[model samples]
Target: MSDIQLPEDDEEQQLYERETENTPETPLIRRSQSHESIISTLSAPPAYELYPPATTWSGRLLNFFRRIPTRFTQSSIALPTLSDDRADERSISSRFRIPQLELHPRIARWRYPIVGLCVLCITIFSFLLFCSIFFSPASLPSPSVPDKIANDTAKFLTLNIFMRPPGVKNNWSDYKDDRTDFIIRHVLPNYDVVSFQESFGFGSRRKDHLIRAAREMGYNHHVESGRKYPWQIAVDGGLLVLSRFPIKDSRLIEYPRGRHSDWMARKGAIYAQIECKPNSLVHLYTTHAQASYQQITSLWDDDVRTRMNQFSWLHSLIAETSGKDGSAVVLNGDLNVDAAVHKEKSSPTEPSEESSEEYEFMKAVLSGEGKKINGKVEYEDSWKIDLKDAVYESYGFHPVTFGDVKVDEYGMVVPAETVLTDADELMAVQSIDHVLWSPRQSNMNIEGVRVEKFMVADTHLDNDEDEEKGYTQVSDHYGISYVLRL
Candidate 1:
């Protein structure tokens, strides 16, 4: 291979030699030479040219904005200055075209992983959203009506007014007004036979207020639960059976005993034989059994056990009172058993058996078979009723929530003056409140009597303290109604 070489020019070689040779020159001579170089460059004509004035008035107006200098950090682009001769190659006034960027190898290596992670996140979110829509426990639809009867209907209503615990309702006679209003507006006009739990008053005022409301509302006949002296007690144990018809031979029976907190009240049963028509007579038994009070750690807790006893007692009372009278018999009240479904987490202190955990009293009521304390009630659930009104149907029933309340066109909150929907309406399960009728398959003539319509009032107001929060109802539990074709 030959070594490559280039010919050297004489003038360039001579200048390099002169610069390499060190000269002891004075400061004044160096200064004069620097000044002369600056003068020569400044005197030269400019190579680049500014763009011509914009032709359109709008474009010319932009010249005012161009005077403002942009800081380096703010400027996103840099442009190259072209020489005067190169200006003919391209127009400076034309728009700057975007160029493709050459990404660094390090950044390009991470691009695929980032895209994969984003897709994975989106997929997971979509799957969760899909599951929420289809599988959420809330918003479960109520069960369809078992058998809508084609017979004539006799309306019956039963409600737990939450009228007791007068101390709780001491605020401006809160529940008192609600009870009166509901009876007059909703009950009197609609229901034929009405039964109320906790209808008695506190202190010396037993039936004065409720009696007035009933009479004023046109419920002329009121039967006290079978007691020798109906008006003797202090709290009235607050159970009363009011009839639009003649209440014949009606009485009240107190449970043998109550458990835990229920001992405070003389809780018991109310039974009435009503003449629905000249020939049509129906026996109605109403009772508020000892409540389980709250969460039961053990199925064998005193509350559950006592409630069982009360159930048996109630069944016995109904059997003795009605006794194959051939007349239709109906039972109504808050049994406090989660009938359809209950899977409460058992307390560790009390190991829970599946049988013991859920109320066994419910088993007896549904199947109409249990301990022979009252010799078993042969009653069936009203075609497995469902449609809210069931406690434990929801995590907790809070009536006063700031839900999507109706609003005016001006965006003001339009408050409701009355109860719109009752408790448990959202849950399509019958956890507790019910209407038990003797199935009339045996009575061919009684085929005309059928349970027509069952509805639960949304009695729980959104705000318990604030009157404006929810529906104006006193009871935490909803009132139950039925259209019984007599």
Candidate 2:
């Protein structure tokens, strides 16, 4: 061993042994101890096969094409061995295996419940649609026309029809075609002239339907206010006048100022000269003034200020056009000005009070009291002429035309607010809708032309059976109608 002179390290020793000993050089590739050939390395799984296949076929195919270079490089390492029995099967399975989704246990458990919920929603929607189409309310039978009245007598009505646009939510109800149709068929035929405020939703299906129905019912002549400005987004003023009589001339005068959302629509009055009979012309004016909300308690609210401005403008219009040529002036509208609001006492220190300054001012302005526009034209609230005494004696004052009342499920008239109990309490709320007229001459006003028929229309729901308990009006305000004997 010492003479062998081993090299400094194992490298020199291996070199000496290989050179000195008679041996054959090993081949570049050799078999492993387990007899597995080096070529088996090429049969290993491709790069993409390490992860599970994508759920979608398109995704799987995309992965296949995207990893082609990686597969090619891996396969190029060595050729497949002919000795391997499952080589082709392994290759085909790895490249084209179908995906298997692996959903969590919790998600799979709730799948049926989610599907059932979707089905339930779809069923409810279909049922609502079916009810809306088939079970709709039909129009009531038309009432017979009244017998021909004296040539000098004329009938007029004012109503806030509540034909607001769709999608708006209110305290009473949504817009109903049956109510509108009922008014057109039954209410309008009984009167010579009708003025409607809040007859909004111009060009909508509801408005168009009402117009068509009115025309069919012999209300051929009509007039409405125009837009306040050309570039406005809101519809035209919500005032509409439908008359069986012939209209000689008509015009709309929009107020220069509006408050709150009232500015969106052109709020104004419709002035029409309607011939009630042969050579008997009546100057008719219909308007919808600024609206004050339920929360308002002060007389100096913005809505009040806006209404005062409109009132002044209205006075000017009547003074300029009405009471001329001996034509009778009739003013009809939802004034939104209550005659009085009775506030109940809260404690011993507090006392009940009634506020009515707005109502007083409105009367003064219309009657030419200190206002320059009222020099020639003077007006009087028609309800106060003759019916006031009877109304006062029975109910203490004129009943409210506007109140928080609605029909319950059982079709009973009930107060919407919890503070009130009986529907009669509504009479104490306040009176806003009215009919005011000035005499053909102040001398002949009270003597000749009285409110012959001072009646309230639509005081009960159309199909209500209990008149005493179910005295619900279709609109938010009651319809006021009267007969004028000239």
Candidate 3:
């Protein structure tokens, strides 16, 4: 305890310090401190452990194998770990581990349904297109033979004849000779039976000319009954039927006189019976009744009324005499009375007092009012019937009048405009020329009949003319022809 003097010598002091240092700790506190220092150094956490695991090598390896199906499954499967920190992080990582979808599965499930839907739509459209092509109304087939036959049978016979001798001037002598020549060269040569109106002859030799002409033309069976004027200036006059067939009977029927103080005389119609075939008879009538002009309307009315009476009478006669015998009746000629008057409802241009009378007469005739003769006789206006069906069919026969003729071409008789003014006038003028027959007689084969506007060439007349100036012909009316096959 005496002053624990320290050695001063350096080497001898170091040896002495080692010896003292190597001795067991003298204090309990110092021994504990030494133990604590050793333990702290040995138990200290590594810097690498503070951070996340070094997954570079494992991650690379896992990604490499993930492309394969089996490896991908194994890699996606969560593995259980022992580290508390790693376990906590695993929970979070698992939340984000989204499952990869298989490309083949998606395509396989969706492809067929989409394709089927498209195929169904295409099939439906194709079926509709096929049906439209084959079964549409516009694609219907042609008419059958039976339909054609029926249509043909319903048709009418129409004929147009021109009887003007060529190279004849507009003189009376020339006119007479030309007419005679026409009867011989054109009428007799071409037709077995003939009906003519406006058979005007020139000079003082009227009767002689007509008789001679008729005889020469082989028309031994003839009827000539019409208004005869003193100076041969007869108006609203006509001729009758002259045929090669056997003549059975004949008569003249007169028309009514209207309120015309200035008219010269009443008009008339001629009816006759001709043996057209073996043991068969046909009624034939001809007339030149009235003109449609306002100045002559009263006269026309008178003439039309009378003609209607005659028509009715003739029908009765045929029904009584021939209809029972199965004989057909044909009323042919220029009645001057139109079968249908389309303008009955309209007012006339430059109308006069007599215009109304004429309209009434026309309306009466067309409406079948004045057609009665003896209270029981009935005659169907064949022209009207044929016209009604004209829109659907070409019945072949139209009357010879101003309405049926065209200026650009030479018609059988005259330009249609000269006669027809409107629809009413067209109906009236169209059937003015006709050859009506009993449906039961003449073999009644409508299909075999042909109606045509006799061409001007056939009548030995020039048809071509200047379009602006109209036709250059002789007559004011056209000639209608009917060809009936018995």
Candidate 4:
């Protein structure tokens, strides 16, 4: 390149300076000052030449508004102030356009990651909401009935169905919906009277399904133990009594004492006077007593005392109601009192003093042996009657109604494949489930009562096959049934 030479005259020097300031290498301050000097050279004009008065009122009002300053014009980006002589033939947008804002470098770098995190959070929340709606009991469909129905004339059944509330650790019965389906289709149709314990749930949940199913299967009469508030004491005494026979009267009596979590349950007895025949009435009582919780042999513990108190209360209720009428009275439920001389949890060989006392006291109360009543009547345990017969000796020890399968610490029943000892079998068969009956003493219309059949019916879910892969029980306690001849 050739060396640059300085301009000699004043006009030539001024023109050279302007050209130098317009170059790309020159700073923006020099260029801005040059534009300001050019604008200052324009001559001042008359008000009519600057802005002519509008011909119409509306046009004049619009012209007035155009003169007012706006936020956009007041911003840091200075817009050119054009006079009439300098105004160009350009659109309003081109004349005054706002520049786009640029994000900071740090914020722009994390844009994609932030968007991805937000999407993931929304997806997880949607999935949780779907699961809560889909798995709820209210959303479940009714169970289908089998074509082969098993209906008997007169039979009695009692079981603890173990229907706990959902979302709890203790709601451990696997395939709970399937188990309930089996009961409605196969079991309820065969029995004349059915009583269930531990049917716990809220609103139209598991228990409501059974109620609707039973009513459809001709079990029209039903009674549930009343509910209690949290402040009053506990929830409902989870008892549901169903009968094909017409029920004349019904009452529930909750025990005053309890132990552990049993204190939070409405554990009690339910009494129902049902018409077995057109003119023949039967007094039915169902109850669920205090749980042992692996401490069955402790006679001096709070569990034992609470149980004793419940028994006494039950005895008084029976004496006051059916004892005076001399009607056919039948008591069936989970009493939590084993008939065995010794319990499995205690010394295997040594006799349990608690068991002996419980058995004797239970028998005395049922038979009205010591308590003075208006009409003294005797009641017999149906299992004892059936086992005492010489012909029925091959029937073996009493059928194991509960604990054949163990429940883990979280209240889930162990699998059927879990091997149990001989002592376990011996103890389980002598469980607390029982049925006691007393024929009417003064009524000639009623006949003598005899247990034609006694069985611990399997309440397991069947798949309609002879040999199955594994056994799945409906509840911890088996359903005990009695086919009676009256």
Candidate 5:
């Protein structure tokens, strides 16, 4: 190697001298001067230069080795001459080194750990979901009917009978025949016991009709009771329980007579206790409660209060009797009282004049709203039977409505007419009509105790005539019947 001399007064020397010199000038002037110098230097060719291709093995090796640190020093080695561009290339190469590992194997091995972790997470999530579905209470099964009881009991028959007897002027002679024919034909052949309501006793003719019907049906045990009118002729609107079994004891429970003159025409309940088996007795209660009356009248309030007291008394009496005898009781009747209607909630705001008048009438009869009848004796109205539970046990015992009467459409029953005029009366009628055993006959499991089919027996009643006339033909309500298996 030899020491080389360069030309004097070259562009590079000029640029260096210009950059070193400083002048007291404005910032804009300095920046412009600096920019001009930079452009001139960038355009000028290199003062000393050498060229070498980067593709050579030795060159690449040298470039590769320059990037790594070493413990030994090689200070005696001569430095290679390189152009500014070549030095830039070498500097870039020195910054990064190619890894010695295989590219495919590295990628394959890298994916394994990620894939494994993902699979493990998925499996854990699936296991948790499965456990939640199977072990939760929502997945539990509902109770089914017990197989043991189903296999033992035979299917019992049920029958419903309704009669709208023709008036005495129409056919007085055939009344007994028609009554006897119904028992022998429709009732006795189908059911084990027949329960009757609205059994009119206008004279010996009506009594003879029931007696002959019971005789024809081979029902040796029968009962009938009623109030005697001023004419001394018995107005036979009483309940009768006819059965093949012997009659034990029977009594008519006279409900509180409403002070209203119209209420006197309505009848109270008939309670009976019949011996179905040697050591077992089944109790029967049948009645027709108060009728629907107009509002702003004393009759409407009196009827509601009277009916409420009647139910309270009946419940107390039954509770006492059933408690004492430990007997399975069947309390069925044509209770004209509407449970759904009584339980409705009304707003205090004044309605339209027409609706307000009707509502007032309904409120008078309802007296105390939400006052439930079939409830625990201790808690008053606090404990009432859930309607859904009661209907589930008995299939046929359902709410029936005439005309536009609806029950529980919006969780409350509403009748077409609260007041009963001759034309609107028939359309206004609505009732539960029939309520089966509270706990249901099929659900009873006590030994030597069973309740057979219980239903309303007014399927045959013709409801075509005008309200008053039609109501008088048969009782305004249906009758309840039940058979007990002891």
Candidate 6:
């Protein structure tokens, strides 16, 4: 740096010039240290500095943030130099309000818990609504079809409908709509007479629902097996018949013996005599024999025995009731008797007329092989007969395998897994739901029943919805509709 020469009034300037020019200067007299300090004593006070001594980058940032307000900080230790009322008079623009200022420690602590509670409340409410509507329980309704199917001897439908009693099972999860609405919308509109097994009416309002719905749908003629008043009937023998034509007569017969859960309801048969035409009367036997041989079965041996016993009663009832007349008779129901599908090792893919032990009992009544058991009335299965005929043989039937890949139930194809069993092929491909007819007594060789169209209605292909475990398919069993010409 260059030296600064003070204007020291010639004497100090000449000395500085002489020193810089390399010339010797005269020596000044030395004064005493205390006396010179005292003589030169007083100096001016120092001036204020514009900026503080913060040199490094971090130091500069610390100084800058120290000037900000403390209300914006949860802990102001980072800016300890900042005062409480820093910029108290500054006006914050309304558009730039600070949300962090309003955050409370307590509210922050419970924030997630409160949100979780709200979500839980919504989920519970949704579940309740689902139960009350889709799954809650069960119904019936009006018909749009004519009172009688014209010119046909028998136009009928039979289904199990899986009408389990209210609150007894988890039906709330299995169905997407009320069973009555489903029947009115899907099942009843297509057939003349719809017969349902397991239509229990003991303590619940379902029986009333069906009657009311049926009447509304123009199916004014309907009957129940029996009513115990409040609790008289066992588990509601659950047999019901709804007909478009007038039901001239109706009767109920509860079996004497039922085992296990069968004891819950008096399992039985119900039949009705309908006037199909002026001179031609049709005896419609709508019956549901006992079946304790379900996948969810208990007391297997006892259930089997009980089911057979029930069938015997059913046999006797049909024999006594069915007359050897020219009038037509259709015994249709969830008979729970499949002649070909009993053996665990049987391939379901093969549709053969294979008989199980229980099938013999049913065969005796239907085929008139009961030479010892009165040998009076003989009946015929509509499907087996239809297969032999030319015109109506093309129609299809499907077994409701719950979730298994399906096959035509009318012995059309064999199958793999079904809803009830893990076996690769089902025992047989036919439905427990059966449709049988009594041949014209005039000619023993002529069953006299021609199936124009025999269909397993509301089979898996009928619905657009997936068979979700908790909510799809109104019943485990599909409905059956048969157009018969006798």
Q: Over all chains combined, what TM-score does candidate 1 have?
A: 0.48
User: Once superposed on the true structure, which residue ranges of model 2 sit more than 4 Å away at CA?
Assistant: 1-150, 171-173, 227-231, 294-299, 341-355, 370-396, 404-428, 442-472
Give lDDT for model 6: 0.54
How big is the positional error of residue 211 in model 2, measured in Å on the Cα after superposition? Answer: 2.0
Off by over 4 Å in 6: 1-149, 170-172, 229-233, 294-301, 342-350, 365-368, 371-430, 442-470
Model 4 clash pairs? none
214-248 per-residue lDDT for model 3 (tens digits): 55545566675543433433333335466656678
Best by lDDT: 2
Per-candidate TM-score against the hidden true structure: 0.48, 0.55, 0.44, 0.55, 0.43, 0.53
Superposition TM-score, candidate 5 onto the true structure:
0.43
User: Each model's C-alpha lDDT?
Assistant: 0.51, 0.59, 0.44, 0.58, 0.41, 0.54
Give one digit per residue, the lDDT tens place, for model 1 in 382-470: 22311122222222321221111234699654432224332223222233555566633223122222221212244332333334423
In model 4, where is the ten-residue run with the lowest total lDDT? 385-394
> What's the count of clashing pairs in each model shown?
17, 0, 18, 0, 2, 12
lDDT accuracy of residue 247 in candidate 1: 71
How well is each residue in 1-486 modelled by candidate 2, as lDDT tens digits?
656765466656567576756743422221241124434543577777777779999789667655744533442334434333443333432443345444467865675576568879999888767544433322433423332323766667788877765554354445356567557655766777788887764444565566567766766777866522222466667788887777889888988657676767678888998876666667788889887754456655778767877876777777677635657677878888886555554321221244377776566655555222335433333222111112223334445666544567997765543321224344335567766666654222312222211122433335643334221345656667666665
Model 1 CA deviation exceeding 4 Å by range: 1-151, 169-174, 204-206, 225-234, 343-360, 363-368, 371-430, 440-474
Q: What tens digits encode model 5's per-residue C-alpha lDDT throughout 98-146?
A: 4333335566456546656877999988876764543222211222222
Model 3 Cα RMSD, 1 decimal: 35.6
Question: What shift in Å separates residue 183 of candidate 5 from its native position after superposition?
Answer: 5.1
